[model samples]
Target: MTASHNWPPIDPADGWALILTELQRDLERIDPDLVMGQVKQKFGTLSVSAEASDPALADAVHGRIAAAEALSARICERCGQPGRIRQRPDGWYQALCNRHALEAASEMEGES
Candidate 1:
Protein backbone atom coordinates (compact mmCIF):
# COMPACT_ATOMS: atom_id res chain seq x y z
CA MET A 1 0.00 0.00 0.00
CA THR A 2 1.17 3.48 -0.82
CA ALA A 3 0.76 6.67 1.11
CA SER A 4 -2.88 7.57 1.29
CA HIS A 5 -4.15 10.00 -1.34
CA ASN A 6 -5.38 12.18 1.52
CA TRP A 7 -2.23 12.14 3.66
CA PRO A 8 -2.13 15.17 5.91
CA PRO A 9 -0.52 18.22 4.34
CA ILE A 10 3.05 18.84 5.45
CA ASP A 11 5.38 21.59 4.33
CA PRO A 12 7.93 20.26 1.87
CA ALA A 13 10.71 22.20 3.51
CA ASP A 14 9.91 21.06 7.01
CA GLY A 15 12.31 18.57 8.61
CA TRP A 16 9.42 16.22 9.27
CA ALA A 17 8.88 16.11 5.52
CA LEU A 18 12.15 14.26 5.05
CA ILE A 19 11.28 11.81 7.80
CA LEU A 20 7.91 11.02 6.26
CA THR A 21 9.40 10.55 2.82
CA GLU A 22 12.01 8.17 4.16
CA LEU A 23 9.32 6.35 6.09
CA GLN A 24 7.29 5.79 2.97
CA ARG A 25 10.28 4.38 1.16
CA ASP A 26 11.19 2.07 4.03
CA LEU A 27 7.65 0.87 4.54
CA GLU A 28 7.27 0.10 0.86
CA ARG A 29 10.42 -1.98 1.00
CA ILE A 30 9.13 -4.02 3.93
CA ASP A 31 5.62 -4.48 2.61
CA PRO A 32 4.80 -3.08 -0.79
CA ASP A 33 1.10 -3.18 0.09
CA LEU A 34 1.25 -1.45 3.44
CA VAL A 35 -1.35 1.28 3.68
CA MET A 36 -0.13 4.52 5.12
CA GLY A 37 -3.03 6.13 6.92
CA GLN A 38 -2.65 9.52 8.62
CA VAL A 39 0.66 11.30 9.10
CA LYS A 40 0.52 14.22 11.49
CA GLN A 41 2.45 16.18 14.09
CA LYS A 42 1.08 16.74 17.55
CA PHE A 43 2.82 18.43 20.49
CA GLY A 44 6.19 18.36 18.72
CA THR A 45 5.96 14.67 17.93
CA LEU A 46 5.53 13.03 14.56
CA SER A 47 2.80 10.41 14.41
CA VAL A 48 2.67 8.09 11.43
CA SER A 49 -0.45 5.98 11.48
CA ALA A 50 -0.54 3.03 9.12
CA GLU A 51 -2.36 -0.21 8.45
CA ALA A 52 -0.23 -3.16 7.43
CA SER A 53 -1.99 -5.81 5.38
CA ASP A 54 0.25 -8.37 7.07
CA PRO A 55 0.52 -8.44 10.84
CA ALA A 56 4.21 -9.23 10.54
CA LEU A 57 4.88 -5.69 9.32
CA ALA A 58 3.52 -4.10 12.47
CA ASP A 59 6.82 -4.11 14.35
CA ALA A 60 8.69 -2.53 11.47
CA VAL A 61 6.12 0.23 11.08
CA HIS A 62 6.21 1.04 14.77
CA GLY A 63 10.02 1.17 14.74
CA ARG A 64 9.99 3.70 11.94
CA ILE A 65 7.49 5.88 13.76
CA ALA A 66 9.63 5.85 16.90
CA ALA A 67 12.74 6.91 15.00
CA ALA A 68 10.88 9.71 13.25
CA GLU A 69 9.52 11.04 16.51
CA ALA A 70 13.03 11.19 17.95
CA LEU A 71 14.26 13.18 14.97
CA SER A 72 11.34 15.60 15.17
CA ALA A 73 12.42 16.62 18.66
CA ARG A 74 15.58 18.14 17.19
CA ILE A 75 14.00 19.90 14.23
CA CYS A 76 12.51 23.36 14.38
CA GLU A 77 8.86 23.19 13.42
CA ARG A 78 8.63 26.79 12.21
CA CYS A 79 11.82 27.18 10.16
CA GLY A 80 12.96 23.62 9.51
CA GLN A 81 16.25 24.40 11.20
CA PRO A 82 18.21 22.54 13.87
CA GLY A 83 16.77 23.19 17.32
CA ARG A 84 16.33 21.92 20.83
CA ILE A 85 13.13 21.03 22.60
CA ARG A 86 11.90 24.02 24.58
CA GLN A 87 8.88 24.43 26.77
CA ARG A 88 6.81 27.57 26.76
CA PRO A 89 5.39 29.25 29.85
CA ASP A 90 2.07 27.64 29.09
CA GLY A 91 3.79 24.21 29.12
CA TRP A 92 3.63 23.62 25.40
CA TYR A 93 6.76 22.11 23.88
CA GLN A 94 8.35 23.02 20.56
CA ALA A 95 11.60 22.64 18.72
CA LEU A 96 12.62 26.11 17.58
CA CYS A 97 15.50 28.36 16.68
CA ASN A 98 16.69 31.13 18.94
CA ARG A 99 14.99 33.84 16.93
CA HIS A 100 11.64 32.14 16.79
CA ALA A 101 11.86 31.15 20.42
CA LEU A 102 12.48 34.75 21.42
CA GLU A 103 9.66 35.93 19.24
CA ALA A 104 7.26 33.43 20.77
CA ALA A 105 8.32 34.42 24.25
CA SER A 106 7.74 38.07 23.41
CA GLU A 107 4.31 37.29 22.08
CA MET A 108 3.43 35.39 25.23
CA GLU A 109 4.61 38.29 27.39
CA GLY A 110 2.48 40.65 25.37
CA GLU A 111 -0.50 38.43 25.89
CA SER A 112 0.02 38.65 29.63
Candidate 2:
Protein backbone atom coordinates (compact mmCIF):
# COMPACT_ATOMS: atom_id res chain seq x y z
CA MET A 1 0.00 0.00 0.00
CA THR A 2 2.97 2.31 0.60
CA ALA A 3 4.30 2.13 -2.93
CA SER A 4 1.53 4.38 -4.17
CA HIS A 5 3.49 7.66 -4.28
CA ASN A 6 5.12 6.47 -1.07
CA TRP A 7 2.10 7.72 0.84
CA PRO A 8 0.42 4.95 2.82
CA PRO A 9 2.46 3.64 5.73
CA ILE A 10 -0.26 1.09 6.36
CA ASP A 11 0.58 -0.91 9.44
CA PRO A 12 -2.56 -2.57 10.68
CA ALA A 13 -2.53 -3.75 14.28
CA ASP A 14 -3.16 -7.40 15.16
CA GLY A 15 -6.93 -6.96 15.51
CA TRP A 16 -7.38 -4.61 12.58
CA ALA A 17 -5.63 -6.71 9.93
CA LEU A 18 -8.74 -8.11 8.30
CA ILE A 19 -10.65 -4.85 8.47
CA LEU A 20 -7.79 -2.91 6.95
CA THR A 21 -7.24 -5.45 4.19
CA GLU A 22 -10.86 -5.12 3.13
CA LEU A 23 -10.60 -1.37 3.43
CA GLN A 24 -7.56 -1.33 1.16
CA ARG A 25 -9.25 -3.44 -1.44
CA ASP A 26 -12.37 -1.25 -1.36
CA LEU A 27 -10.25 1.89 -1.61
CA GLU A 28 -8.43 0.53 -4.66
CA ARG A 29 -11.71 -0.22 -6.31
CA ILE A 30 -13.08 3.24 -5.57
CA ASP A 31 -9.98 5.01 -6.72
CA PRO A 32 -7.36 2.84 -8.34
CA ASP A 33 -4.81 5.66 -8.24
CA LEU A 34 -5.56 6.58 -4.67
CA VAL A 35 -2.66 7.68 -2.50
CA MET A 36 -3.21 7.10 1.17
CA GLY A 37 -1.73 9.09 4.03
CA GLN A 38 -1.44 8.38 7.73
CA VAL A 39 -3.88 5.85 9.12
CA LYS A 40 -4.26 6.05 12.86
CA GLN A 41 -6.62 5.18 15.68
CA LYS A 42 -8.40 8.21 17.11
CA PHE A 43 -10.76 8.22 20.05
CA GLY A 44 -10.57 4.40 20.14
CA THR A 45 -11.61 4.06 16.51
CA LEU A 46 -10.07 4.01 13.07
CA SER A 47 -9.04 7.26 11.39
CA VAL A 48 -7.72 7.42 7.87
CA SER A 49 -6.42 10.06 5.46
CA ALA A 50 -6.52 9.60 1.72
CA GLU A 51 -6.19 11.74 -1.41
CA ALA A 52 -8.69 11.83 -4.22
CA SER A 53 -9.16 14.05 -7.24
CA ASP A 54 -12.88 13.94 -7.81
CA PRO A 55 -15.29 15.08 -5.14
CA ALA A 56 -17.55 12.14 -5.88
CA LEU A 57 -14.66 9.76 -5.50
CA ALA A 58 -13.61 11.45 -2.28
CA ASP A 59 -17.11 11.02 -0.85
CA ALA A 60 -17.08 7.35 -1.72
CA VAL A 61 -13.66 6.98 -0.12
CA HIS A 62 -14.92 8.68 3.02
CA GLY A 63 -17.88 6.31 3.23
CA ARG A 64 -15.53 3.34 3.14
CA ILE A 65 -13.37 4.84 5.87
CA ALA A 66 -16.39 5.36 8.06
CA ALA A 67 -17.51 1.79 7.50
CA ALA A 68 -14.13 0.44 8.50
CA GLU A 69 -14.07 2.58 11.62
CA ALA A 70 -17.51 1.37 12.66
CA LEU A 71 -16.42 -2.26 12.29
CA SER A 72 -13.21 -1.66 14.24
CA ALA A 73 -14.99 -0.04 17.16
CA ARG A 74 -16.56 -3.35 18.13
CA ILE A 75 -13.34 -5.34 17.97
CA CYS A 76 -10.59 -5.62 20.54
CA GLU A 77 -7.45 -3.70 19.71
CA ARG A 78 -5.33 -6.71 20.73
CA CYS A 79 -7.60 -9.42 19.33
CA GLY A 80 -10.46 -9.52 16.86
CA GLN A 81 -13.07 -10.60 19.41
CA PRO A 82 -16.00 -8.34 20.16
CA GLY A 83 -15.19 -5.39 22.40
CA ARG A 84 -16.12 -1.95 23.57
CA ILE A 85 -14.29 1.27 24.35
CA ARG A 86 -12.69 1.34 27.80
CA GLN A 87 -11.39 4.33 29.65
CA ARG A 88 -8.15 4.20 31.58
CA PRO A 89 -7.64 6.11 34.83
CA ASP A 90 -5.43 8.49 32.93
CA GLY A 91 -8.31 9.13 30.46
CA TRP A 92 -6.84 7.10 27.64
CA TYR A 93 -9.33 4.85 25.87
CA GLN A 94 -9.13 1.60 23.93
CA ALA A 95 -11.39 -1.02 22.42
CA LEU A 96 -10.80 -4.27 24.21
CA CYS A 97 -12.54 -7.56 24.86
CA ASN A 98 -13.05 -8.90 28.40
CA ARG A 99 -9.98 -11.15 28.31
CA HIS A 100 -7.52 -8.53 27.06
CA ALA A 101 -8.95 -5.86 29.33
CA LEU A 102 -7.42 -7.57 32.36
CA GLU A 103 -4.01 -7.70 30.75
CA ALA A 104 -4.24 -4.03 29.80
CA ALA A 105 -5.28 -3.08 33.28
CA SER A 106 -2.35 -4.97 34.78
CA GLU A 107 0.04 -3.16 32.47
CA MET A 108 -1.46 0.16 33.46
CA GLU A 109 -1.18 -0.72 37.13
CA GLY A 110 2.46 -1.55 36.60
CA GLU A 111 3.01 1.91 35.12
CA SER A 112 1.39 3.42 38.20
Candidate 3:
Protein backbone atom coordinates (compact mmCIF):
# COMPACT_ATOMS: atom_id res chain seq x y z
CA MET A 1 0.00 0.00 0.00
CA THR A 2 1.20 3.51 -0.75
CA ALA A 3 1.80 5.86 2.12
CA SER A 4 -0.61 8.71 2.67
CA HIS A 5 0.71 12.15 1.88
CA ASN A 6 0.63 15.32 3.90
CA TRP A 7 -0.15 18.83 2.78
CA PRO A 8 2.29 20.36 0.35
CA PRO A 9 5.01 22.38 2.07
CA ILE A 10 3.64 25.75 1.06
CA ASP A 11 3.53 28.96 3.02
CA PRO A 12 1.59 28.61 6.25
CA ALA A 13 0.69 32.29 6.62
CA ASP A 14 -2.46 31.64 4.62
CA GLY A 15 -4.12 30.16 7.69
CA TRP A 16 -4.57 27.07 5.60
CA ALA A 17 -3.19 24.43 7.94
CA LEU A 18 -6.66 23.32 8.90
CA ILE A 19 -7.97 23.47 5.39
CA LEU A 20 -5.04 21.44 4.13
CA THR A 21 -5.49 18.89 6.84
CA GLU A 22 -9.16 18.47 6.10
CA LEU A 23 -8.51 18.25 2.39
CA GLN A 24 -5.87 15.56 2.87
CA ARG A 25 -8.23 13.49 5.00
CA ASP A 26 -11.02 13.65 2.50
CA LEU A 27 -8.71 13.05 -0.43
CA GLU A 28 -7.30 9.92 1.18
CA ARG A 29 -10.77 8.52 1.45
CA ILE A 30 -12.08 9.63 -1.93
CA ASP A 31 -8.98 9.01 -4.02
CA PRO A 32 -6.14 7.16 -2.39
CA ASP A 33 -4.06 7.11 -5.54
CA LEU A 34 -4.42 10.78 -6.24
CA VAL A 35 -1.45 13.05 -5.58
CA MET A 36 -1.34 16.79 -5.14
CA GLY A 37 1.08 18.21 -7.70
CA GLN A 38 1.25 21.83 -6.67
CA VAL A 39 -0.25 23.93 -3.92
CA LYS A 40 0.00 27.68 -3.98
CA GLN A 41 -1.89 30.88 -3.50
CA LYS A 42 -3.14 32.66 -6.59
CA PHE A 43 -5.46 35.62 -6.94
CA GLY A 44 -6.15 35.73 -3.22
CA THR A 45 -7.18 32.12 -2.88
CA LEU A 46 -5.77 28.64 -2.50
CA SER A 47 -4.78 26.84 -5.67
CA VAL A 48 -4.09 23.13 -5.67
CA SER A 49 -3.10 21.14 -8.73
CA ALA A 50 -3.58 17.42 -8.36
CA GLU A 51 -2.55 14.43 -10.46
CA ALA A 52 -4.49 11.21 -10.94
CA SER A 53 -4.56 8.38 -13.44
CA ASP A 54 -8.26 7.68 -13.32
CA PRO A 55 -10.36 10.35 -15.02
CA ALA A 56 -13.32 9.80 -12.75
CA LEU A 57 -11.10 10.01 -9.69
CA ALA A 58 -9.57 13.19 -11.03
CA ASP A 59 -12.94 14.84 -11.23
CA ALA A 60 -13.74 13.94 -7.65
CA VAL A 61 -10.34 15.16 -6.47
CA HIS A 62 -10.67 18.41 -8.35
CA GLY A 63 -14.05 18.99 -6.80
CA ARG A 64 -12.56 18.63 -3.35
CA ILE A 65 -9.71 20.94 -4.19
CA ALA A 66 -12.20 23.55 -5.36
CA ALA A 67 -14.05 23.31 -2.09
CA ALA A 68 -10.83 23.90 -0.11
CA GLU A 69 -9.87 26.83 -2.29
CA ALA A 70 -13.26 28.40 -1.74
CA LEU A 71 -12.82 28.14 1.99
CA SER A 72 -9.38 29.77 1.83
CA ALA A 73 -10.78 32.84 0.10
CA ARG A 74 -12.63 33.76 3.28
CA ILE A 75 -9.79 33.10 5.66
CA CYS A 76 -7.01 35.50 6.57
CA GLU A 77 -3.69 34.37 5.18
CA ARG A 78 -1.83 35.91 8.11
CA CYS A 79 -3.95 35.16 11.15
CA GLY A 80 -6.56 32.61 10.20
CA GLN A 81 -9.31 35.09 10.98
CA PRO A 82 -12.34 35.75 8.83
CA GLY A 83 -11.26 38.02 5.99
CA ARG A 84 -12.02 39.64 2.68
CA ILE A 85 -10.05 39.93 -0.51
CA ARG A 86 -7.87 43.01 -0.90
CA GLN A 87 -5.64 44.13 -3.70
CA ARG A 88 -2.07 45.25 -3.36
CA PRO A 89 -0.45 48.15 -5.19
CA ASP A 90 1.20 45.55 -7.40
CA GLY A 91 -2.30 44.44 -8.45
CA TRP A 92 -2.09 41.13 -6.68
CA TYR A 93 -4.89 40.14 -4.32
CA GLN A 94 -4.72 38.49 -0.93
CA ALA A 95 -7.19 37.27 1.64
CA LEU A 96 -6.41 39.13 4.86
CA CYS A 97 -8.16 40.35 7.94
CA ASN A 98 -8.71 44.05 8.53
CA ARG A 99 -5.65 44.43 10.74
CA HIS A 100 -3.38 42.54 8.38
CA ALA A 101 -4.67 44.50 5.44
CA LEU A 102 -3.75 47.72 7.15
CA GLU A 103 -0.31 46.40 8.07
CA ALA A 104 0.29 45.14 4.56
CA ALA A 105 -0.70 48.47 3.12
CA SER A 106 1.73 50.25 5.38
CA GLU A 107 4.49 47.80 4.57
CA MET A 108 3.85 48.33 0.90
CA GLU A 109 4.24 52.06 1.49
CA GLY A 110 7.56 51.32 3.21
CA GLU A 111 6.41 51.90 6.72
CA SER A 112 7.81 49.95 9.68
lDDT winner: 3
Local distance difference test values of all predictions, in order = 0.75, 0.79, 0.81
Candidate 3, residues 1-112: lDDT per residue as tens digits?
2215544654556487788778878888887777667778899998888776478888888898899999999998888899988998878899999999998998989943
Model 3, residue pairs in steric clash: 13-77
lDDT of 1 by residue, 1-112 (tens): 2554435666687756777677767777776777767777677667677777689888887788788888888877777678777888888888787887898899899999
Ranking by lDDT: 3, 2, 1
Candidate 1 lDDT for residue 43: 76
Pairing residues by index, what is the TM-score of model 3? 0.85
Best by TM-score: 2
**Rank by TM-score, descending?**
2, 3, 1
Q: In model 1, what are the clashing residue pairs, if there are any? A: 1-32, 1-33, 1-34
lDDT of 2 by residue, 1-112 (tens): 3324544544556787778778887888788777777777888877778886567688898898889999888988788889988887678788889988888889889999
Summing lDDT over every window of 10 consecutive residues in candidate 1, give the lowest-scoring window.
Answer: 1-10
Whose TM-score is higher: candidate 1's or candidate 2's? Answer: 2
